[model samples]
Target: MSSYADLLKTPGVARIIAAQLTARFPNGMLSLAYLLHVERATGSYGAAGLVLAATSVGQAIAGPLTSRWMGRWGMRPVLSLTLVVCVLSMAGIAFLPLEVWGYMAIGFVGGLATPPVQPAVRTIYPKMVTSRQLTPLFSLDASAQEIIWVAAPVVTTFIATQISTVLAIVVAMVFMVGGGAWFIASPEVGRVRIPRSKRAFGVVLRRPPVLLSTVVGFLLIGACAAVEAAVVATFGHGGPESGIVLAIFAIGSLAGGLALGHIPVGPWAMTRRMLIVFIGMAGVVFWLDFWWLSVWLLIAGIGIAPALAVMFAIVSSSVKFSDTAEAYGWVGTGQLIGAALGSAVAGFLIDGYGATGGYLTAAAIALLGVIVSAVFKRAHPDLRGRDASPIPDTEPVPVQPS
Candidate 1:
């Protein structure tokens, strides 16, 4: 499974992975595209930021509910409905000439309608492949996702700058529709329906492993946000160099994720690797030269994807089949909130104390993740080579109408 050929050989795996990636491409592009479009329209960065914030807020609010809906209603119908709403909202943002409030409301609606593609696809993975294939499959999925982060910005920026911002957004909308359609049409997605949980949504989060993973995942992603802010600030805010720095960081993550399946390490080793990288990043706070900063970020990014892969594995193994999507949605929400908080905290610190403050914020957050992991290690028995079995699937599976 180390090679791409072996991974692609899994029946229907390639098709679903392609569908998932295609559906997710816009996720990486939409924020920057929306920001550029709004800024161009309003002639104010502040307005653009507010619109983007609205979008994030909407997404954060909807993520768990959407996941719950997917479990309740099944993937095809829910995804089809959300995708249509998302597309319409994108078109509204592209075509309408709205004030800040208008833009914010539309952006919020767009985000609220954003498809839960990641959680849906991930939840389906275990059912698609054997237990032995799960690790490499997740590793491949994580690594491939880096392509979206790296490519979407380049494509969006080029189109927005060379053509019209409106056109760029339209292009993203086209991709979103096309990808979502492909995913919804896949037979595998249509066939599977996760049993609904008898317990309340809050009960799922009450599980020890779920709770710990959510918190740790939040801090880890928060550290990433801080580092991104610091990198941009390091090169002077809005500098062209910031994009390259981020791309390189993503490349490092891609490399690490590709290597994860080959490594013979316990689950806890993933956390240790993350801690070491964060320490290295914290050490680089003293030396703020651009070249050195880039090198530091690259090194720091090496564990990002692997750590995420580990987190996904842990969450998948720890939760009931019924709770899988919602559990992931909770983790996704943590990452989103953490990112917003990290950027806000880093921005405030950078204003007062320069790039050093941002770097330090990132380090502190990473260390906090380490502390949380250590303290709650018992919750994650998988770290110690023991499976954290799901709460039994006692609920009856609903019959799908043919």
Candidate 2:
């Protein structure tokens, strides 16, 4: 496996990664920015929550379609058109004085047009580097994503509170447009086109490994969302302290991803590690003191990126190359759905029983992921430490010349 430094040295890899990161940074900010903006304008958290829900619903609905479009129409055209619509919709939400219905409509449109940057980049990764470098590359990618999650909220909150909520949203929109444009224009993205899959849309998700990964991803992300809500509830909202606590969780994930390169392990080792950490986190939640809670969160956080990296590796190895982008889209949708469920459920629990209920909810969700993994172990050949080869059943589509 190549070291992180060596991976970046691969021609054109670093540029795409940078552009992808910029395009995705807005993801971390969008929900919070919307929440603040709507709540302030309408004086109703209910309205704000509804708008956020619309955005998630829109993204979940649009994700697979967008990925398929990328395959058929090519990255540049799909991304170019979507980026334009996304920026405009975001501007509408920020600047328009319409009622909650208008905000919901605009938010949905923005999410529907959310740039397919992550899936596009992941689809291009195998073409950029040798098979041996994949694990490290994925680990580095996962780790870098933590930085976006850590920093984006801080920046968004500062601008929204210090300057204006409208400006905060505009800033996020600018990054999305600038980054999406640069990514679409990249030489590598322009040179290669993913040949369209002949199978019906969503068929790729029928494969057991892909389905399993999507379900597990949902559970894991849901747990993270619950934990976030609990942490914020622990320290009341609208303070800098909660942000620092969340950053600690991300830092733990970063440390774990970086450490994964040094450990020589079989294919599903990361999954097992994730399960163990989740169990530990559940047990530690009983402590409940601020410092103790933070310690447990940090420990649980260690498993997050590693688990995601391994899931991506498994999905990559399990499906035909043509199915790659759509497979990732399904996984992304699972995550979005999970986060929504987690927050909604955790909010109810916390309101009724306090932070303890939130912790318990997270633990239960993690255990559900474990159960699913165990039951489907046979279905996931890659998880069994089998030879890391692409599934032989499907023929790979060659990259079409532009």
Q: How high is each candidate's TM-score?
A: 0.94, 0.94
RMSD of each: 2.1, 2.2
Q: Put down candidate 2 lDDT per residue, 1-402, tens digits, no spaces.
A: 348888999999899889899989999999989999999999999999999999999999878789889878888889898899999999999999989999999999988998888888888887788777776777788888998999999999999988999999999988898888788888878776777788799999888878988999899999999988988887887566778878988998888888774343354564585686586569756777767877777888888888887777778888876778888899999999999999899999999999888888888888888778777776555433342334432555555453
Global local distance difference test of model 2: 0.83
- Candidate 2 differs from the real structure by a C-alpha RMSD in angstroms, to one decimal, of 2.2
Q: Cα lDDT of all candidates, in order?
A: 0.82, 0.83
- Give the alpha carbon lDDT tens digit for every residue of 1-402 in model 1: 446567688889999999889999999889889989999999999999999899999999878889888878788888999999989989988999999999999899988888999889888888777666676677788888999988998899889998989989998998899899999888778777877766687677887767877888789889988988888888864567988888988898888788765453364755675786686578769898767777877877777887777777777777888898888888888889999999999999999999899999999998888888777777765534343223447756664642
Report the error of model 1 at residue 111, Å.
Answer: 1.3
